[model samples]
Target: MHRLKVQGVPLILKSIVQLLHFGYHQAMSCLFPVAIFGTLALSNVVHLPFIYRYDAILLVLLGVQYFLYRSGLETRDEIKVICLFHLIGLALELYKVHMGSWSYPEPAYTKLFGVPLYSGFMYASVASFMCQVWRRLRMDMTGWPGLASAALLGGAIYLNFFTHHFIPDVRWWLTGLVFIVFRKTWIIYRVREATYRMPLTLSFIIVGFFIWLAENISTFFNAWKYPNQHQVWHLVSFSKISSWFLLAIISVIIVAQLKYVKARRVWGD
Candidate 1:
């Protein structure tokens, strides 16, 4: 027992160091989008062309995306994943904006049907952060359901976002699906040399909460406006976290597709 304790100390410290490194990279991935948005918001005081600000920000994000790949900060596979997320997000944005779910107040040369192209990056950033964290921490999962069931759940969750405006909102029903499907799912992440884990549903809530907080920051920057915010900017209602919780599930499902295909896990029964 004494010898075992002596050997465990170094392993424990190493895991802590690795966890910090993972956190740093995770933070850096999000910084790219938030920093760009914040800077452009601040630069509003400067004069620019008809399509300058929004288009310029879009171009800058594209450049950053390319640089991250070229610099090997992001893997090719991760790049593909992020791009898919961008398209998925853009499609959703187009629909939501058409439905009057949210409004992008700024005009841009890159606007398509009243949806700014840069808006896609907001969703893609979530995937980028997830991918970076997954890679850095060597994440894996236990008790994930079959792809078919997951696809059905994802479809329902997404459809609920649109259909809710007119039809009955089934989000609570889908939330039940999420709980049932992921009840046993565990997200295993490595800190350094040690592996740690939490329930996948809990991770969904935690990530959703942070995204909700980020939404507050984004709204404060006037990235988009909710109906209530049109009159006064207030803290986004916590109720939105339930919506973000659903979106986070979609993001995780997309990233998990790649992770599931590429990596075989030891935990699945």
Candidate 2:
């Protein structure tokens, strides 16, 4: 374990050196989008059956990473620029959870409040991968593939409210608004590029439908109970469809990002 820790320090130091090599301006642009998505995943790792209280305990470690990365003799302005994005993102996440759109159990044994810390850091790394892929493929394709993500997020929220599974008393409008803006933003970019709209629309539909099968598998496995056990299904577990879709989109987005990078090197970027 001591050797592992000593070895890990060099790797951590290496990442810092590499990130510093990136310079400040480039890092700032990519950080926000990365953090937004990463926290989403950390939320999942917390609940993984593989480890109990994995999410809560990770916060301290994540905090250390966050500070270490933001440390050294850096400009306050630049630090604030990165910090503000996470603060807002984290705040928004808190709001989203409070609204009952999602949740994590008590933090007594963990550091995460539904969203885990390393998860945010993890997303930051993935975003770096995505940034490279986006450069080669162009924003439209990355954003294009992401239309499915936007819908899977939007549709699940819609279903939650419609089914009366999760009620939103206040700030519910924010959820819909967030989805609309994201969807419209993607469409605006596509239309601006004068790309074919039909194919893009079809892609989202296909991804959405793709989630149904995973829901069936999980239902059979008893991995979940729907509507917080308010509504249960015996034939096939349909309760987790939205959450599954959300998870699916994240998985695909990351894989697509990696594949885009691999294809570029093979063909010579």
What does candidate 2 score on TM? Answer: 0.31
Q: How far is candidate 1 from the true structure (C-alpha RMSD, Å)?
A: 4.2
Candidate 1, 1-269: lDDT as tens digits:
99999999998987788868777866766755665566557646554655566787788788888888898878898888889989989999999999988897777779998888988888888888889888877888889987998888998898888788899998888999999998988999876666789999999999999989888888887778887888889999999999999999998987897788766554463
Local distance difference test scores for all models: 0.84, 0.42
| Overall local distance difference test of candidate 1 | 0.84
Candidate 2: residue pairs that collide: 56-110, 56-111
- Residues 174-199 of candidate 2 have per-residue lDDT tens digits of 33444454453342122122332323
Residue 148 lDDT in model 1?
A: 90
Off by over 4 Å in 1: 1-19, 44-51, 264-269
TM-scores for every predicted model: 0.87, 0.31
